[model samples]
Target chain A: MIRIEDLDFSYGRDGFRLTVPKLEVAAGEKVAWIGPSGSGKTTLLNLTAGIVSPDHGRIVVSGEELSALGDARRRDFRVRRIGMVFQEFELLDYLDVLDNILLPYRINDSLTLGPEVIERARALAEGVEIGDKLHRDVQKLSRGEQQRVALCRAVLTGPDVILADEPTGNLDPSNKERVLDILFRYADEHEATLVMVTHDRDLLPRFERVLDFDELCTPAPAPAQEARA
Target chain B: MSDSLYLAWRYMRHHKLKTAILIGSVTLILYLPLALQVLVDRATEQLSARARSTPLIVGARGSAVELALSTLYFESRSPAPIRMAEVERIRATGLAAPIPMHVRFRVRNQRIVGTTLDYFDFRGLRVGRGRPLAKLGECVLGAAAAAALQAGPGDRVNSSSEALFDLAGVYPLRMRVVGVLERTHGPDDEAVFVDIKTAWIIEGLGHGHQDLASVGAEGRVLERKDGRIVANASVVQYTEITAENEDSFHFHGDRSGFPLTAILALPPDDKSKTLLLGRYLGRDETSQVLEPVAVMEELVGTVARVRSWVIAAVVLVTLATALTMVLVFWLSLRLRRRELETMARIGCSRRTVASLVVCEIAVVFAFSVVLAGALTGVTSLYGPSLIRGLIL
Candidate 1:
């Protein structure tokens, strides 16, 4: 369900670079990218989500080449085919929990917010144990509740790939387990691919595959070239 | 666009106090200039209408604006007093009919205008209820004055004292309200009309006391020499005129010498108007004769100039307010940058995000326009009274 090859990305002039020769995750696979800080794990998630185009890369998700698509099409693909959960649980504060969950439909014209979609959203909120607080502002929710709201928003589109960038970074141990269990349950039930980046090592055993970035990506040779000059 | 507007509405609703302040600021910015323009236009129209109707005024040599305002609108400080003889002098000219005006006293905030019945005929003032002034101590109130005092025909209105500390000042006369004038929507709508003699009584020039020659006057009489009887301060004086004592109310001196505020002279033709105006044009003329239109026009011209200055200041203030509003929006945008970035990253287009901001501003502007329109409508409806209050 996901493929990347010859990925070479950089934050230019900062001398930071990422290199991935070949990486693939099967359909329905749950994968985790674990590494030290600044290991470019979150960057890869953003690239896969098409939020930013890599300097050079060929990325395929669900039979569509993300790098080949235009900016608008890439955005559309991201909204329709890939669900993203952020470490910060980036929900708009002005909106209540339901609006935050339905944000994907509100922002993208490809999805229509019909009565059925509203029913589905309510069901999704009920599944995540936030049905009663659907009208409460996301800002007033607990950190765990906010993450669940973000999870509901992510899966509301029924995307093929769920990319979670440390979804439980700010939660307590119990809440972290609950959020992870819900994410895994959704991937298992829907046959969706899951790619999560995290710093915690204890959560690694639950994933189908764990890619350690310490060996996978090597920094570019710009400083060596500078020394030679 | 609808979606963007819905999102904007939610954002604004979440920040309710901020939205209200913005709407109020914009409303005042839009309303101040509009209300001023309406008020100035209405004042010009009303003042010109009243001045054009009155032909001429004769008052003590002083500010013509004051004399015109006091005599025509019963507003401004009462002009220097001219004797009732001036009214007779204009009558003697055989060119115009003189209507004496004594606008010197007040019943609370309402001005009491003392004039003859000719004033009612000349101004086309018809009584809306009961009868016009037919006797001394009987008054006809203007519609607004009566409404303000909540007094109708058969109600009594007492004159307000000129000074609080005057130990021997004139007593307040409890005059019977015989009628109420139909509303003309001019200065006349806020005045009380009475006979000149009643005004003199208010001025302490005329009074009634117990008859010293009667049987009960033995203690009150100070001297009884010749045909004149002198009375002491202890003598009982009537504070009001009734049917039995109306005959006893008398002026102390010659009636011609009593003070009048102005004389309204209505000439029959242009030749008479010119002749009457020429009579008062002499260098040594004690009283000034003026065409009310000319005096009012000069005053209107000054107001127009001041209106221009006010409009210019308003324009500058409007520009400054607009700039400040823009700055506020710009700062708010900066503060909400994170929220906007989240929207874009969530697949909202850059254009849609921008539309959301624009929609918020548009809603605020729409509310402001409606509020300003409502305020301007109210100003237009009550413009005449507002002008009266402003000038008076």
Candidate 2:
């Protein structure tokens, strides 16, 4: 469902580059990128979600190369195919939980998902134990509830893949376990690929494969003058 | 689109104070210019209407607008008194009819114009009460004047030379109100009518009062006869109207020395008008004959220029205000980066974001337009009275 080959990105002209030489995830695969803070885990997820373009090489998601698309086309492609979750649970404060879930369908208008799409969203909310908060404003919910709502919104559109950036970062132990369980169960039931960036080591066992920062990043060069002397 | 509008409504509902401030600013920008336009248009209409109605206005030599305003509209300062001889000269020409107007007094704040009965007949004025001013010292009040002073027929009221009290000048003249004129929606509604002779009496020309005492050892005392307060009661003194006093009102000392602001001439034909104009213009050094309609056209032209400039200024100001509001709204959108980003991540398009901002501004503008229209309508309805009150 997604592939990255020799991808490199930087914040500015003088900033250090973040490089991912090669990565791939097959369709319906649930994978996790576990790394320390500032190890470019969120940057990789941002690249996959098409939120930011890479400086070099290709990022192909569902057969569409994101780096080649214009700004408008890239945004359209992202809304249609890629669903993203944030660690901060970035749900629109003004909208209720159901409206937040249905936002993607409203924006594109061509997405002719059936009544079953709404039923699936409601069932996902029940699975995440946020069923009672469906009609409530997102701002009124607690951090864990908000995170679960974000997870529901991410997979509500039945997208090809879901990119969650530390989805359960603020959750307690039991709530974190519940949120991850719901996320993985929905991905498997819908045959949707899941790629999550997280620092929690306990979540490593849930994914089929874990890509650690040391395995993904290129090694730094040693000093050249010491051997010459 | 629906989503954009819904989001816009939510934003406005959330920030009520900011929306109110924006609407108020827009309303003020629109209201002032619209109200000014109404006032200027009505004033121009009234001025032109008066000018078109009066065929000829003869007054002491001065501004034709002032002359027309005074004779036809009863507005502005009193003009220098012209002789009845000018009326005779114009009458002998036989080119057109002539009506003399003597405006010298006021009952309360309303002007009291004393002209011949022909004045009312020429203007087609109708009385609402008893009769016209057919007798000396008898008067007809305008509807507004009657209502303002609460005076009716058979009631006597004191007259002054000004719209308001001028105690240092002449004392008020006592006149009996005999009639009231119907409402004309013009200056006539604010005037009092009387015979020209009464105007002369009010001007200190005809019969009234004279000093009845002489300076004596104890200052002054009324002359006594048989212990009665009789002092030159039957004698003809300065108070009596005589043939000599009548001649004094007629200025023959110098034909050119006559006091007249302007003359309103209604010639029998275009040729006669040209002839009358040619005969008067450049015939004297101190006076000039002017066409009121022509001067009024020129005045309107000047006013149009000023009005265009003001309209342009108002339009520019409105445009600038709209631009400022849009820019402020745009900046506010930029400031809500996190919120908008959240919406964007939830599959909202860039178009939706832009539409939300535009929708919010449109709602504010619509409300402002309605508020401004109501304010302008109210001002237009009462503008004349407000202006008159301010000026008077």
- Chain A TM-scores, per candidate, are 0.94, 0.87
Kindly list the per-residue Cα lDDT of model 2 for residues A117-150, writing each as its tens digit.
Answer: 7888888788878888789978888888888888
lDDT of 2 by residue, B73-188 (tens): 67777777777677677778876566667765677688878877877776678998878876666788888889988998988887765434664445456778889888876677
Worst 10 residues of 1 chain B by lDDT: B383-392
Candidate 2, overall lDDT? 0.73
The runs of at least 3 residues in candidate 1 whose Cα sits more than 4 Å from the true structure, single-residue gaps closed, are A220-229, B92-94, B124-131
Candidate 2: CAPRI quality band: acceptable
- Itemize residue pairs with steric clashes in candidate 2: B56-B264, B57-B264, B59-B260, B59-B261, B59-B262, B60-B260, B60-B261, B61-B260, B61-B261, B62-B261
DockQ, candidate no. 2? 0.30
- CA-only RMSD, every prediction: 3.5, 8.3
Query: lDDT tens string, model 1, B145-241?
Result: 9999999999999999997889689679999999999998888999999998899999999998777788978888888888888888998789999
The superposed Cα distance between candidate 1 and the true structure at residue A201, in angstroms, equals: 1.9
Q: Model 2 chain A, poorest ten-residue lDDT window?
A: A220-229
